[model samples]
Target: MNEVAQAAAAPGLAVKRNWLAFGTGVGIEIGAADLRVSVVRLRPSGARLLGEKTIEGFRHRPAAQWGAEYNAFLRTLGAAHLAATVLLPRRELTVRTLPMAGVAEKDLASAIGFQLDSLHPYAEEDAVPAWARLKG
Candidate 1:
């Protein structure tokens, strides 16, 4: 069995990986109530979770304090060298899904941009929009 399998079998053990060899990535999501960080190793087969951490008490904290704590947590995971992606709070995002029968994949982003004013709650200039086709 691989290290991932062993970690799965042992509930309390943290998943370990040589992230440098795997070119891993870290994803951080700052939600209203908690902050979550997940380290993933991308492979030909699929992405595997190397580790993850969630910290509560984010709702009322100062921004500087939260940044310090988040940095410390990443250091603990040895994730400072990894590429990171941060997801802002969902409340700040405007998300919508529309079905267009003949929209080509190449024109999707442009099409979304053209319709942003009607699809999003905020003004087109104020809102940032992202779209992906849903698989049926």
Candidate 2:
């Protein structure tokens, strides 16, 4: 059997599956002063850029207006039933890499929560944290 089939059969072995299968996908980015959208087509071989557009005046507009504009833009692309991912501006995110040694998977969340205030600018109550372990 192939590696994929073997991994799927073994319950103890965790298999990483491609969440974004071969198809068109929309990536939306909401920036402080602009909104950008990109349509990409993914195949087993590679990815192809289908379309991309950026609009200004995000800082001056309200959330509802931006939502409407985004809907209209998606309509223009006819992006129906396509996988989509929205990315927030980098400025709005606080990213950190914490070195965790000898920590179990189940206890990582609580461990990070304990150090949230020190790792990020916001207090523990105000911050949302997510982490992934790096493979060597």
Using TM-score, give the best candidate's number.
2
CA-lDDT, candidates in order: 0.75, 0.77
How much is the lDDT of residue 66 in candidate 1?
77
Residues 8-84 of candidate 1 have per-residue lDDT tens digits of 77854433432324567889898878989888877655678878878677778887887787777778777777667
Give candidate 1's whole-model lDDT. Answer: 0.75
Candidate 1 vs. truth: CA RMSD? 9.2
Give the C-alpha miss distance for residue 124 in model 2, angstroms: 6.4
Q: Supply the TM-score for candidate 1.
A: 0.46
Residue 133, model 1: lDDT of 82
Model 2: colliding residue pairs: none
Please give the range of 10 consecutive residues that has the lowest summed lDDT in model 2.
12-21
lDDT (tens digit, per residue) of candidate 2 on 1-136: 9997987888644323343347789998887778788988877566888788786797787878876777777777778557679898777788778888898989988898788767777655777777777886
